[model samples]
Target: REIERDALRARLRSHTGSRAELAAQLGISERSLYRKLRSLDRPD
Candidate 1:
């Protein structure tokens, strides 16, 4: 799960778009996206 989340984050960051826009494209809420990113920032 962590690896996949990291990959998804990398793929999203690779493109040029607003976070809100990217979240929408990913079918998630902006808040949820932010939460996911925040969680990903933590060392496992």
Candidate 2:
């Protein structure tokens, strides 16, 4: 689920839209997106 979320974020980022807009398109709140990104990047 985390990997999928990261890939979704990357795909959204590649589009010609602002981060806010991309988060909207992904159907997640912008704060939630940021939280997810941070969680995914955490070290083991």
Candidate 3:
């Protein structure tokens, strides 16, 4: 799950889109995506 999370975070960082749009691409809620990101120890 961590690996997937890292990959998703990386993708989120690289892509040029609103957080809602990126979350949609990953099939997760925008709020959930923010929570996941907040849980991370490092900033992108």
Best model per TM-score: 1
Clashing pairs in 2: none
For 1-44, candidate 2 gives per-residue lDDT tens digits of 86776687687668897768877988989898788778767764
lDDT of 1 at 30: 92
Full-model lDDT, candidate 2: 0.77
Off by over 4 Å in 3: 42-44
What is the C-alpha local distance difference test score of each model?
A: 0.82, 0.77, 0.84
Q: Model 1 Cα displacement at 25 (Å)?
A: 0.8
lDDT of 2 at 31: 95
Report the CA-based lDDT of candidate 3 relative to the real structure. Answer: 0.84
Could you tell me every candidate's TM-score relative to the true structure?
0.75, 0.62, 0.74
Rank list by lDDT = 3, 1, 2
Clashing pairs in 1: none
Stronger candidate by TM-score (1 vs 2): 1
Each prediction's number of clashing residue pairs: 0, 0, 0
